[model samples]
Structure formats: C-alpha cells, structure tokens
Target chain A: MSVTVIIAILVVAFLAGMDGILDEWEFQQPLVACTLIGWLLGDVTTGVLFGGSLQMITIGWMNIGAAVAPDTALAAVGAAIWVCGPAHLTVAEGLAIAIPLALIGQGLTVIVRRLVVKLVHYAERSVRQGNLNVITRVHLLSLTLQGLRVVIPTALILLVPTTLMQTFKAGLPHNVVMGLAVAGGLLAVVGYAIVVNMMATKWLWPFFILGVVLAAITALNMIALGLIGLALAIIYVQLQSQTRPPSGPDDEMDELDRELEDL
Target chain B: MTSANNQMPKTLTRPDLFRLFWRSSFEQGSWNYERMQNLGFVYVMMPAIKRLYDTPEDQRAAVLRHLGFFNTMPYMQSTITGVVANMEVQRANGSQLDDQAINNVKVGMMGPLAGVGDPIWWGTFRPVLAAFAAGLAQGKASLIGPLLFFFGWNIARLTFRWQSQKVGYSLGVTITTKTGNLLPKLTQGASILGMFVMGAVIPRWTSIEMPTVIARVHAHDQLEQLTLQNVCDRILPGLVPVLLTLICLWLIRKRVNPIWLMLGILVLSIFGYSIGLLGVK
Candidate 1:
C-alpha cells in the first residue's frame, strides 16, 4: 500500500477504535470495521461478506462494566485487509485468520487498559496541581495511545509478505482447521446465551427456547428472535404492571407518583 | 470560593477540545451537561482555568452554553440535556465542578442511555444495514456492498449526532420520542430480509462437503449421492453451523474463558484437519 493508503487505513482504524472506546453501536462492530478496511484495500465485496459472517457470529457479544468481549473489529479488519488485498485469499480463509486475530486484539486491549490507568492517574495529579493544560495533554495522550495500540498491529499485519502468510496457511493441519471452525460455531451459541442470561426473566425463556428452535429449524435468525424477544418483554412488563395490587391510598399515591416521575 | 477567582476563561485549545470531545463522547451511554463539564479534559481544565485567569460569571456561563450541547455520543441527547441543566445550577453556586462530580453524572447517565441506545443502534439500526450489505455481498456486486454499508452507517451516525445535539440544545427533551420507536420495527423488517440472504450465502461461502455415503432404500438399491449440504439441511436445515454455535454457547455458560475456548478451537481444528474430518480449500 502507498503511504497515503497506509495513512488512510490508520485513520479509519483510529476512528473505528475511537468508536469502540466510545461504545457506539454499529460503527464499533466488526462488520463495519472490516467493510471499511476492505473498501480501503479495494475489495469491499470480500470485506463485507467476511465482515457480515463475523458480525453474525459475534452479534450478542458485549462489554459490560470491566468485562471485555473479543475485539472483533480488529480481527475482521485485520483479516479483511490481509485476504482482500494483493493476497486474494478466499473469504473462508479470511475467517480462519480472523479467529486468532480477534484473540490477539483482546490481549492488546487488556494491555492498553492497564497502561491507560497510569495515564489517568497522572491526569488526576495534574488536576490537583491546577495544571489544566497538562491534564488536557494527558487525556489526548490516552486517546492517541489507544489509537496506536490498534494502528501499530494493523500496520504490521498489512506490511507482512504474502509468502509468509501462505506458508503459515500451508503448515496448518486440515482436521484442526475443521475443529476450529466447529469450535468457532459453538462459541457463537455461548455468546447468544450470555446475552439471554443477562436479560433473564421468566417470560423471556420462551423466546430463548423459540430462538433455539427457530435457529435449529433454520427458520429464523438472531434479528427475528430479537424482535420476538422484544415483544414478549413489552407484554411481560405490561402484565406485571397491571397485576400488581395497589397499596393503601397514600402509599399507592406515592408509588403512582414515583412511576409517573420515572416516565 | 477564592479558588474560583484564579483561572482564565479562554476558549479551549484544539487538543483540549479533542480530549474533551472524546471524553464526553465516550459517555454517550448517558448524556448530562454536568458530566460533560467534568469530562477528562474539561474536568482537569476547570481548576487550572481558575488558577490562570479570572473567569467572570458570563464567561463561565458562555463556556457552559456550548458544553451543554457537547454530546459526541449517539442516542444520549436527553441525558446530556440533564447534565447541562445540572452544570448551570452548580456553576451559579460558585462551586468548582470537579472530576468526581463529572464522573458521578456520567455514571448516572450511562445506564439509562445504554438501556435506550443499545437496542436502538445495535439491535436495530445495525442489523438493517447488515441485511442490505450482506445481500449485496452475496450477489456479484460485491464491491458495492461495502460502499453501501459505509454509506448507511455514516449517514446514521452523522444524522444522529447532529440531531441529538440539536435536540439537547434546543428541544431539551428526551430524544427517544415517537421517532425512536419506529427504528426497531424497521430493524426487524431488515433483519428478516438479511436472514434470507444469509441462507443463500452459507453454502456459497463455505467449503462444506461430505464423503460419499451409501444408503439402501430397498434390497439391491444402494444410493451414494449424499453431499454435506444434504446432510446439513436434512438434519435441521442449518444444523452444522447451529450445532457448532451451541457447543460454544454451552462452554460460555459454563464460564470458561474465551481465550481458552479459542485455544481449544485452534487445536481441535488442526486435529480435525489432519484427520481428514474437516476439509479446507
């Protein structure tokens, strides 16, 4: 890639990473990131295809509080750039590459978080010393550092020779690759389960079972199941509200006021 | 109170603004003006600003006016408005809005914003675009697929950001009005369309093949026309992939670390590949 292309790729990566840090929706997703990378590499088709598959596999993935999900954006984008570039690798092959890349990206994120903590502490000290300029510098430094964490790895992957990648691919055993695929598929179910478990309500279990059955029958995808889930959630909330007995007049009025207040 | 007299009221530097933007942007999970003021850059700058120049009441008010609209995060317009209101009250009291106070507002806003934003953008908007992109990718017009994907996502992001800020500043009401409710319906429709495209892409994209197996329907009737698709579809239509996903789900429920799951997959894939059970081309 030319310097301009490289710069463009890094800029996209920065924006994508920033989106992730900000926890924006689809922009932080692997599907979007890979597609952007693919567009940059001049093979949006392969990129979108691979990205969509990865997105489905990781659809229910999330980062709750301190827990972090695998960095799918890095995996999808890295693999897309690798496969859809001059290498001309197939989508399946790109997917295989994405698995490990995602893992590595997660590790890199953990390290970045650890490093950022120190910077945050320094920023706190700057605040105490009444140095707003230094504090601002530190905050910018953290964002830049986070961006670099993604950009550096991506640059290295992009710069690597095709022959090396080919050799790595050649050395892998066939059954192991198959097993990994099987394993990858299985992990997706777990991802879905985690989401379901988080939103665990008795009535919602039907939707979960329905999701499993629909998925088994190949009659529905996550989106369909999610819609059904949403409907059931609304119904459940409505029923719960209606069935609850009202307390005495004053208490009931207070409860009613609180409910109205929340709205 | 004297500390309030120390700082300057200059417009923020570019880098400070960038940091402030990002800090506030990340807090999109909940928007409040108070939280925006205490964001990493803004929080740090307040005390320093007091030390550097004497910030008059109007200057403080002016600095706060724009800060109230600084919602870099999508779907957080309502909470940002609340924060802005809180900041206006606190600044008027002559109390320095510190980092902790800013973070407290952030912590308050994130949960509600996340509750609202996640479903709207992640569960709804994303799947809609993915459907179109997936359809395009599967067709011969693959190159256009990504372009379409970017166009849809950027359009949403830019439009949402602009609208959210405007709503926060002008309307000063929750942005999740009647319009927000329409997105899930749209998303559901798009998801159904995407699923159909995905069905076609499965066999086309993957190297799924099965060994020739013999089936005897009658005495002397041996059949050897079975392929992977036949086995996969016959078992449960999409059993192979679904079964694979279930196994992973089981492990995840068991609380096995994802790293271990990945490692296990890598090792198993190599073994399966070597044993000729799984084929890759």
Candidate 2:
C-alpha cells in the first residue's frame, strides 16, 4: 500500500478507536469505518459490501454499564484493512477474519479500560489541585490511549506480509470457518437477549410474544410494525394513566420498580 | 448551597452551552470499571464547573463531587448534563441543594433513563435503522446502505443530543416542580412504545429456524421426516426464535453473567451446528 494510504488507515483507525469509546459519531462501527477505509484504499465497493453485513452482526454490541462489548472499531478496521488492502479476501472470508478479531478486540478494550482507570486517579488528583487544563488533558489522554489500542495493533498487523494471511486462509478448515458463520448468526441472539431482557417485564411478556408472532406469521413491513407498536403504546398509556388516581410517590416508585427488573 | 437571593451570579452563554454539548459526546471516554464514566462525566461539565466555582476549593469540590460512579445512555445523557449544569449554577447561586442532593439526582436519573433510553435508542432505533441500512446494502443500494445509516443515525442522534440539552435547561428545576411524576409517565410512555417496536421487530432479527428433521424414518421413496419449521409455523410462526428469546430471558433472570451467556450461545451454536441440530439462515 502507498504511504498516504497507510497514513489514512492509521488516522482513521485512531479516530475509530476513540469514536468506539465516544460512540458519538460511531465512526468505529463497520458501516462508517469500513466505508472510510475502503474509500481511502480506492476500493470503496468491497469496503461497503462487507461493512453492511458486519454492521448488523455487531450492531447490538455495546458497553452496557462497566461491561465492554466486543471492540467494533478494531474488528471493523482490521477486517477492512485486510479485505480492502493487501489480503483482498472475499466478503465471507473477510467476515471470518473479522468475527474472531471481535473477541481479541474485546480483550483489548477491557484491558485499555482497566488501564485508563489509573488515569482517572490522575484526573482526580488534577481535580483536587483545581487544574482544569490538566484534568481535561488527562481525560483526552485517556481517550488517546484508547485510540492507540486500535492504531498500534493495526500497524503491527499491517507489518506482516499479506501473503502469509493468504496462506493462512488457504489452510483454514471449512467447518471451522462455517462454524464461525454460525457463531455470527447465534451471536445475534445474545444481542436480542440483552435487549429483550432489558425490555422484558412480567406485564410485558405478552407484548414480546405478540411481536414475535407478528414478525413470524405476517409479511408486515418494519415501519408498519413500528406504527402498530406506536399505536399500542399510545392506547395503553392513555388508558392506564386515565384509570390511575392522583400521582403519589408510592405509585411512581412502583412504576419505577417495574422499570428496573435487573437492578 | 442554597439559591440565595433566588438569582444566579451568571447566565451561561450560547458558546458555553455549545461547548458543553460537544464535550458531552465524549462523556464515556474515560470510562473505568471502578467509577464507570465518572471522570468523563466531570470532564463534560467542566464548563459549568468553572463557571459556577470561582474559588479553587469550590472548583476542586465541584469537580471531585462529580467524580463518582456515573453511567447513562450516551445520547440521553445530555439532559442529565444540562439539568446538572443548571443545578450547579443554582448551587453556585447558593441554593439549598447540597452536593449530596445533586449527586442523588444524577445517580437517580441515570438508571431510569438508562432503562428507558437503552431500549428506545440502542435496542430499537439503532437496530431498525441499521438493519434497514444493512438490508439496503445487501440489495442494489450497497453503498447507500452505509451512507444512509451513517448520516441517518448521526444526524438524528447529534440533533437529539443538542436539542435534549436545550429542553433540559429550559425545563430545568421545573422538572421536579411543575411536573409531578411526569418523568415516570414519560418513562412509561417511552417503554411501552419501545416494547411495541421491539415486539414487531424482535422476531424478525432473531433467527432460530429449525432445519432439523427426524432421521431413520421411511416414507415417500426412501427416508422422510417431518419438517420442524413447517410444524412450528403451523403451531405458531417464529416459535423457535421466540422460545429461544424467552429461554435467554429465563437465563438472564437466573443471574447469568451476560458475557458468559453470550459465550454460552456461541458454544451452543457451534455444538448445535456440529451435531446437525442448528443451521445458519
């Protein structure tokens, strides 16, 4: 690859790493990051082709509380680099490369997050001293460490000969690769599980069941279902609120209890 | 600190609000296992902290006070930041709201907001838009898929981040005063809608089609077996995914660590595939 392309990859990787944590722009996500990498490599087509599918698989992976999900930034960028750049693998093979990389990326994120805790202590120190600049710099520095979490690994991977990966791909067994694909499909359940678990309440089980049945049985579009849901929610909220007596702290607390099942 | 004289020392300028809004986007950057996003939370409110506390000790206390455990839905945090900023301003004006109360509000709002926000934004909004975008890419508009998702999600969310803060600031203390149980009612409303959308879409995203069939059965010509998917559809369409989701729900209620459950799903999938019980759609 050209030096400028390498620089572009590094720059994008750094931003993606930081964005992974920020989650503001979501530049770290496959759809955006891979597209950018592909554009940089003059292979925007393949970059997007794989990025689209990867986005669906990793869409639900997020940091809920202190637990970090798989690192989308690292996996997305790393897979894109391999697929769009030297290795030039097919989208399916690129996905196989990307999926396992998610586990590695998850490890890196947890470690980086732990390492950043020391910086948080420093930030605390800076706060005690009443130095806003120092504290802000520390926070940004912590963010940079996260950036390097992806950049350094990506640079190291780039150092290896692309031919080696090609050879490695050739040697990989079909079942194992197929297994990874199946793993990707199954991983969707985890994402849905977490969401369902969050939204699942004793009174709400019927709604969950209703959603599944509608999706399975009918050819209704997503927007149509969303509209149906909006209608159901409005009707329920209106009827329920009207039936309730004057609002009290106890009543609010009970509603809030139903709000937090896991908590 | 009580709101002495019922007036603030200073009003935040537009630039300050703009700066705070921008900074709030990185509110999870310094996330740590011990205190979660506490430092990032403090960092985002630095503008407000600096504006409110002129004395070094006051500023120090202000910063340190926010450096406790804080986590919330990323996009929805702007409201908290805005409300907290206003409270800090009130505190600086010498309000009765002490550090403990401020922290209490911060701590209290996050969970309920997280409960409401996680499902609405991350759970529903994201998956719906993203799946569509991904679907578009799988179709003729491959490039447009990423473009649409990138622009659609970012524009929608960034606007939300900006606007919610404005709404929070405008509503400010009135949230506790003017509206009794309004937040809860809103939470109830939001969650219901969330469940509705979730109901319609969960089955579609969740794939648990059964390709397995009875083995060693003789029928039409050689060996024939009942199609499990057909049977499932006859009983209830999308039964497998729904049942699978419920099983996951049961496991989660049983206090299974989510990460372990995720790994378990992976292992189960591998085993299921190897044993010819599960196949990828």
Candidate 3:
C-alpha cells in the first residue's frame, strides 16, 4: 500500500473505532466502513460487496442496555484490507477473518471501557477541583482511546507483508475454502435470528410468517416488501388505537401488563 | 447557599439548547463500567450548568448533582437532558426541588427510555434499514446503499434528537406521565414492521443449500435422484434457514453466548461441507 493510502485507512479506522462507542455517526458499520476502505484501495466494487454482506451479518449485533455487541469496526477494516488490498482474498476468506476479529474487537472494547474508569476518576477529581473544562477534556481523551482501539490493530495488520498473506491464503485446503464459503452463506442466519428474537412475540408471528411466505415469491423485492411491512404496521397500530378507548393512568398499567404478557 | 432568590428567572436560550443538542452526540464518549455515562452526562450538562448558575458554589453543586451513575440509550438521553435542563432552570430560579429530586428524575426516566429506545432504534429500525441497504448493495452492486443508510439513519436520528430535546424541555415533567403509554405504542408499531421485514429477509438473505444427494426413487419405471434440498423444498421452501434461525434463537434465549454460536456454526458448516451435506451457493 502507498503511504497516503495507509494514512487514509488509519483515519478511517480511527473514526470507526470512535463511532463504535459513540453510536452516533455509525461510521463503524460495515456498509460505510468497508465502502470507505474499498474506495481508498481502488476497489470500490469489492469493498461495497464485502460491506453489504458483512452488514447483513452484523445487523443484529447491537449494544442494547449495557451489553456491547461484537465489534464491526475492526471486522470491516481488517477484512476489507485483506479482501480489497494486494492480498486479493475472496469474500469467504474475509468472512472467516472478520468473525474472529469481531470477537477480539469486542474484548478490546470491554477492556477499554473498564480502563476508562480511571479517566472518569480523573474527571471526578477535576470536578472536585471545580474545573469543569477537565471533564470535557477527559471525555474527549477517552473517545480518542476508543479510536485508537481500532487503529492499533489495523496498523498491526497492515505491517504484515502482502506476500505472506497471499501464501497464507494459498496454503488453505480446498475443502476448507469450500467450507468457509458454506459458512459464509449460513452466517447471516445468526444475525437474522438475533433480530427476530429481539422483536418476536406471540402477536407478531403472523406478520413474520406472512413475510416469509411472501418473500418466497420472486415478484416481491426488498422495496416492495418494505412498503408492505410498513403499511401493515401502520394499519395494525391504527386499528389498535381506534378500537381501544382513550387510556388513563389505569390503562397505562394495563398497557404495561399487556407488554409483559406479550413478552 | 440559599442566596438564589435575588436572581431573576433564568432561561436557556436557543443557543444554549443548540449547544446541548450538539454535545449530546458525545454522551457515551466516557462510558465506563462503573457509573456508566456519568462523566459524559456531566459533560453534556456543562453548557446548561454554566449558563444557568452564577455562584461558584451553585455551579459546583450542580456539577456534583449529576456526577452520580447515569446511563441510557445514548440517543434517547436527549429527552432526559432536556427535561433536566428545564429542572435546572427552575432550580436556578429558586424552585423548591432538592438535589435528590433531580437525581430521582434522571434515575426514574433512564430505564424506561432505554427499554423503549433499544428495541426501536437499535433492534428494529436499524436492522430493517440495513437489510434494505445491504440488499441494494449486494444485489445491484450500487454505491447508493451505504450512502443511503449512512445519511438516512443520521437524518432521522438527528431530527429525533433535536425535536425530542426541544419537546422534552417544553413539556418537562409532564412528558414522563403523558408518555407512559405512547412509548410502548411506538415500540409495538416499530416491532411489527421489524418482525415482518425480518421474516421476509430470512428467506431472501440466508442461503442454505443442501445439495447433497440423499436418495433415489423409482417412478413409472424410471430412476430418479432426490437431494436433501429437493425433499426440503417439497416439504417447505426455506426450511433449513428457518430451522437454523429458530435453533439459534432458542440457544440465545438459553443464554448461549453469540460468539460461541457463530463459531459453532462455522465448525458445523465446515463439517457439513466435508461430509457432502452442505454446499456453496
């Protein structure tokens, strides 16, 4: 890789790392991260394809409450570098590398969050000294640490020679390559399951079943299916509101009860 | 400490609210296992605290008041910030609310908001949008998919954050009481769409091809070959994918770690391929 391209990749890695925790700009998402890395490497097509496939697998990997999901930032950057760079690995190999990297990234993220407690303590001391500026400084510093989390690993990955990576790819058995491709095709199921588990309830099964049945027909594309889903959701909610009387605080309790029952 | 009665009514101008909105984006910058977003929350509230308090003692107290544990869905915390900003304004202007009262409000609102916010924003809306974007990108090989998702999500997110902060500020405490039912309703609607789309996506996105030949049949004196996929299709199309998803969901419910699950899938797929039970599409 050229010096300028390497710098650009590091920058992308930093942003992805920071956004991993910020969850604000979503730069860490594979769709955006891989696409940027792809563009930087002069292979937009492979980058985007890799990104979209990775996005599907990582779609349900979300941080809900305090439970952080596996890291997509490292997965995307690392895998995109291997797949789109001089190594020229296939998407299947990229998938294999990305999954394990996600686990490593998740571990690093947890460690970083734990270490940030020290920084928070510094902010606390600063608060005691009545210097409010230190609080912002501490917070930004912690964010920088997050950005470095991805950048450090990416830098390490980039240090490996391209020929070594090609040799590594060449050494893989044929069955293993075929197996990884099969795994690649099957991996999205895990993501789908997580998403379905998050939203599934007794009342909503029909919609899911309908979606599955409708999706079997080739006529319905994603856009058409999305519109159908949206319409049904709106209509269902509307009918529900109209049928139910105006709810007071008592009804709020009943709503909670219903929500619990649904769960 | 009781010298605030001489001060006139303190209000947060648009610029102040704007600052809060901008700063709220970094709410999780200092997320820690202990006290979770405490420092970050303090950071976001600094602008409001600086603008509302005059006395150093009061500013210190205000800063200390928010130093306790605070965490929630990062985006939804904007509403809490707005409501707290309103309370701070009132307290600065000599409202009888104690420090404990403000912390109570923060604690009271975080859980419920996190509950609603996670399922809607994190679970439902984002995955749905990503599925469409990925489908566009993967199928058509278009650049618009990532750009569409990046811009689409942020636009909706920023608009929600800005508008909800303003509304929460304006509505203040009443929002908690009034929104008791509304949040669940919104979640319900979003989940409905989420479920439907996920169902459709499962059949389309997950590619489980069991092309291994399992049987031979004789019909009308002609030999016929039957693959596992053929039998599966005869029973139900997309059967393997649906079953695999259900098994994973069941395992997840049983508290199986997802990382293990992915690794297991990897091993199983490799084994299946070696045995000629699974094939690449």
Candidate 4:
C-alpha cells in the first residue's frame, strides 16, 4: 500500500471511530466505511459492492438501551482491506472475515468504553475547579480514544505487506474457501433472525408471514414493499390509536425487542 | 422562555448554539453502562451552563444537575439539549423553575423522542435507502450505493437535527403540546413500515437449502429425484430460511448465548459445505 493509501485509511478510520460512538455521520456503516477505504485503495466500486453486501448482513444490528451491538466499523474496514487490498478476496470471503471481526470489535469497544470511566472521574474534578478548558479537553480526549479504537487496528492491518497477504491467500484450501463462503451466506441468516427476534411481536407475526409470502411469490422488490409498508403502517397507527383504551399513557418497556447493533 | 429577546438579560449566541450543536455530537463519547449518556449530556450543556451561571456554586450545580442518567437517539438529542438549555437560562434568570423541571423534561423527552427516532431512522428510512443502495451496488451501479446513502442520509439527518434544535428552542415547553399527537403516530407508522420491510428482506437475505435428495419418484416422462429443498420451496418459497431463523430464535430464547450460536452456525456451515450439503446460491 502506498503511504497515501495508508494515511487515507487511517484518517477515515479515525473519523469512523468517532462516528461509531456518536452514531452520527454513519461513517461506521459498512456502505460508507468500506467505500471510503475502497476509494483510497483506488477501487471505489469494489469497496461499495462489498460495503453494501456487508450492510445487509448487518442491517439489523443496533445498540438498544445499554447493550453494545457488534462493531460494523471494524467489520467494514477489516473486510474492505482484505477484499480491496492485495488479497482481492470476494465479497463473501470478506463477509466471512467480518463475523469474527465483529466480535473482536465488540470486546475492544467494551474495554474502551470502560476505560473512559477514568476520564469521566477526572471530568468531575474539572467541573469542581471551574476550569472550562479542562472540561473541554476531557471530552476531546474521550473522543480521541473512540477514534483510536478503530484506527489502531486498521493501521496494524495495512502494515502487513502485500506479499504476505498474497501468500496468506494462496495458502487457504479451495474447500476451506468455499466453506467460508457458505458460512458468510448463513451468517446473514443469523443477522436476519436476530432482527426478527427483536422486532417481531406476537401480533406482528402476521406481518412477517405476509412479507415472506409476498417475497416468495413476487418480484415486486423491497422498494415497492417498503411503500406498501408505509401505507399500512400509517393506517395501522391511526386505527390502533383510535381503538386503544384511554388509560394513563406510559408504555415503559425494556422493549422486549432487545437487540444490540454497534460495538 | 428561551430568553430569546424580550427579557434580553442574556442569550445563547449563534456561535454558542453552533458550538453546542457540534459539541452535542460527542454525547456518546464516554457511554458507560452505569449512566449511559449522562456525562456526555453534561458535557454538551457545559457551554450554556457556564455562560448562564457566572457564580462558581451555580455553575457547579448546573453541571451536577445535567450529569444524571440520560439516554436517547443522537438524532433527537439536540431537541432535549435545546429545550434544557433554554429552560436552564430561565432558571438562571430567576424564573420560578427548579432543576426537577429540567430533569422532568429530559426524562420525559428521551422516551418519546427515542420511540419516534428509532423507528424512522433505524427501522424505516435507513433500511429502505440502505437496502436500495446495497441492491444497486450489487448490480452494476456499485459506486452510486454508498454515495447515495451517505449524502442522502446525512442531508436529511443533519438538517433535522439542526432544525429540531431550533424548533425545540423556539417553542420551549409548548413544544410538548404540539408534538404529543404527532410523535406517537409517526412512531407507530414508522415501526409498522420497519416491520414490513424487515419481513420483505427475510426471503432475500436469509439463506437455507437442503441439498440431500429426500426421495426418488417417476416423473411424467423420466426418472426423477426429489430434493428436500425442492419440497420446501413447493410448500413455501422461503420455508428453509424462515425455519432456520425460527430455530435460532428459539435457541436465543432458551438462553443459548448468541456468540455460541454464531459459532455453532459457523461450524454448521463449514460441515454442511464440506459434506456437499450447503453452497452459496
């Protein structure tokens, strides 16, 4: 990789790191994250293809309440490097690598979040001291740590020279490679099931069934279905609200639809 | 209520609002299980709090007030931040308000705003555009996917956040009266759409197939073998994937750890593929 490529990846990684925590910019989403890396690697097209596929597999991932979801940022960058770099792996192969990367990112995220507790403790002191500058610095430092979480791992991955990556790719058996491809496809099932588990209510099972049946029979596509969903959702909301009993209004739930998306 | 002009003793300048808007993006910087987004919320309010409360005691109290537990979607955060900042100004100016009122606003807003934001952003708009973009990328228009998604999502989201802050600030407490009817309906509609989209994708994203032949049968003109997956497709186009998903759901319900389940699926895939029972479509 050229210095330009490596530096670009680091900068993107740094931004993604911060964005991952903020959950804004969505620089962490595979679609965007991988594309940025792909663009830097001079293969914006492949980066996008990989990112989009990867995004579907991770579509249901989210951080609900306090639980951290698997890290899409790590999955995107690591998988992008493998797919777009010297290895030139297929999207399925890149996705296979994303599963473990997600886990690793999750663990690292937990640790980083925990480590920032110390910063919070220090922030209390700055608050007491009436030192606005210190208060600002503490927050900035915490943001830096978040950025480094993605950058450090990404930098390390790029440091592996091209020949090593080529040799690494050459060594894997064809069957093993095929198995990983199969694994990647099935992993997507896991992702969807996870979403179903969180979002599906007993009353909502019909909707799930409805979607499956329609998809099975028609080529009407997701966009068309999405439009139908929008119409039905609007209608359902109006009807349900009108029918609902006028009781004291507090639907406090540690939502039974509990699932974590970001690491 | 926002201390906008009439009272005019002080104001949150455009620079301060800009700073706060950008700074508020860091609300999850130190997310901890204990307090969630509490510290970040305090961090965001610091500028406004410091500007409003000149006395050290009042400043420290203001900071302490905001450090309580807070959690909400980042998109909807500026609304609460703006409202609280406005209310905090009122309190600083000797309005007959207590910290509890600000706390009430924060707590009250987090739930409904989140209830609204998640379904729309996470569930509906995001999935719709992303899946569309992903589909495009998978086809020949690969470059368009990420560019459309990034620019499209950020444009809507950034504008909404900025506008929401301004609206929330301008309306003050009355923001509640206007939004009470709107939020619940928007949330319900979005969630419904989200659920529907999720359903549509089940057949597309989830993959399951049975490669083994279940039986041999005489066809109209030739000998034929029936595959298990063929039977499933005849019965239901996505039965295998749906069944697989349900089984995974049951495993999750049974408290089988998700990581272990993921590993199990990993092993199952490798074994199935090695034995010629599973392959990518």
Tell me, per candidate, how large a share of the native contacts it keeps. 0.20, 0.62, 0.80, 0.65
Off by over 4 Å in 3: A242-263, B1-8, B214-226
Q: Cα RMSD (Å) per model?
A: 8.0, 6.4, 4.9, 7.2
Ten-residue stretch with the least lDDT total in model 2 chain A: A183-192
Rank list by lDDT: 3, 4, 2, 1
Write model 2 residue lDDT over A1-263, tens digit each, in one string.
88988998999999999987888887888888988888898888888877876776676676766667778898899998888887887665676567667777778878888988888887777667667677688889889988998999889878989889889878866665655556655455555666666666677766666666677646687777777767777788778877777645667887899889757
| Top-scoring candidate (lDDT) | 3
lDDT of 1 by residue, A1-263 (tens): 78887888888777666555556545557667777777888877676777766665555566654556777757766877876787766565666677777777778766766666666556545545545455446556656665666788888887899888878777756554455555443334334434434444353344434444454434655456445545654665456445756623555797999999999
Q: How high is the DockQ of candidate 4?
A: 0.47
TM-score of each: 0.67, 0.83, 0.94, 0.89
For each candidate, the alpha-carbon lDDT, in order, equals 0.54, 0.76, 0.90, 0.78
C-alpha lDDT (0 to 100) for residue B123 of candidate 4: 61
* CAPRI-style quality class for the chain A–B interface of candidate 4: acceptable
Index of the highest-TM-score prediction = 3
Interface RMSD, per-candidate values to 1 decimal: 7.0, 3.1, 1.1, 2.0
Q: What is the lDDT of residue B6 in candidate 2?
A: 55
Q: For each candidate, what's the DockQ? A: 0.22, 0.43, 0.69, 0.47
lDDT of 2: 0.76
When candidate 2 is compared with the true two-chain complex, its DockQ is: 0.43
In model 4 chain A, where is the ten-residue run with the lowest total lDDT?
A: A247-256
Please tell me which model should have the higher lDDT, number 1 or number 2.
2
Put down candidate 3 lDDT per residue, B224-243, tens digits, no spaces: 88989989877767878888
